[model samples]
Target: MKKSSMKNRLRPLLLTAVSLTVAVAVSACGPADEGAVSAKPTAAGVEPSTGRPTTPQTSPSSSASSRTTASRSPTSARTTSTSTPTPKQAIVKNTAAPRTRAAWPRVTFARLTFEIPPGWTLTTYGSDACVQPVHRAGLPTMFDCAGIAIKSGSIAGNELRSYEARQPGGWYAATDVQPCPVRPTLADGSFNGITSGTSSPPVESGLRPVGSRKAAYDRWTAACTSGYRFSPQAWHLPVSRVLFLDYTGHAETARVLESVRFPG
Candidate 1:
């Protein structure tokens, strides 16, 4: 009986030991450790439970910020440009006005005309054989039956006389035309009337006679008295239809003779 009582005491001790082992296992496997802290939920692109960071979420503001930074980069900076130039021109100037001259007077007679200095008289007479009056120094106030006159003018204080006459068969009438105290005639019977055999004294060279006529210079002497005498120089030009004659005491006579012309 003592042995049976000892056995019951040992069995109660074994049950107590088994119950303490089960409690220890339950405590170890059921819940986490009390010293460790649990993580909270996080944003997108992050470990939610662990609360560790990942790639950040792309927001509208951040995208705009990136574009702004790209625009301000060194390769995209602003710069300046160049331009072109212009040209020049030339300049001119004008200084003074032009000069003019007065018109010379025209003297016309006997189907002919010529130019003379201004304010000169030209008197025509058809009364006696178509006489044209002229005046010269140391000579009579003469008459040209078939001629014209360029009277005294202020240019030289002188007068120049010219004649043009129509004759039969190209004959020259010295008395009716420009009379000389000593007259001359050609041997060719072209001029039948005159005082003596003709002498062909040459006129100044290059003095073309009026029209197609040839030039002749006739020098003559008149004996009015010892106190009054005159030597005259006459230039004659005989053409097909008319004979031209001139008398002038001035050196400008050739210039005056060259100005003669026939009327149409």
Candidate 2:
């Protein structure tokens, strides 16, 4: 009887201990099962519950913020830029008015045209043309005419008859046959009928434009007796068979030359 009672009491204590162990095991496994169910594999191959790769799940607002940052990245911003580049401008030529005196009269020689001061006379002797100030006497003979003259066509009996003639030939070429002053001395346009023993070298010698054509230009100074002086400027266009001369040595000479042009 004593042995039976001892066995029965030990059995109850053992059963109670086993029941506690089973309950503790069930509690521990309960959490694991819940976690496994919640961490089911997602379409992106990431565990949503535990986040095994540690990639934080982005909320709606956070996802939008990320997208906005990507749009403003340097590469993306450059591609989306709408600013336009300025175009280069073209070079333009100067179109200012011609340098000339106002209210001056216009004169035409062959195709060449230019301006002259008022009261200047224009006369033609055969094929030669002459221009002189109104203060001068009657027009001089073809050979003796003072002031500006243009010799063209057959210059009768002069070595300058040949339009193609070059220097040293009297009345026949682009250069002066005699050196003269660049300005005149006599108010009446008269000089002592004698030339001084000295003549100056050409003051300017080159190709100059007259109207639309280029002419050989020559200017020189000539000294006459009684302290008188005369400057002779010449413009010869061989192609047009025209020769222009200025002997007045007046200040308007340069202005007149500058005013030269061609009529269409």
Best by lDDT: 2
In candidate 2, position 211 carries an lDDT of 56
- Go through the candidates in order and give each one's C-alpha lDDT: 0.41, 0.61
lDDT tens string, model 1, 155-251? Answer: 1111122332211111222334333322223345343232321222222323346533455444443332122333334444444233333322444
Q: Which 10-residue window of candidate 2 scores lowest in summed lDDT?
A: 168-177
Q: Look at candidate 2 and tell me the lDDT of residue 79.
A: 66
Which residue ranges in model 1 land beyond 4 Å of their true spot?
1-102, 127-140, 143-208, 211-213, 240-252
RMSD of 2: 10.3
Q: Cα lDDT for residue 177, model 2?
A: 35
RMSD of each: 23.2, 10.3
Model 1 superposed RMSD (Cα): 23.2
Off by over 4 Å in 2: 1-101, 137-146, 155-166, 169-191, 196-203
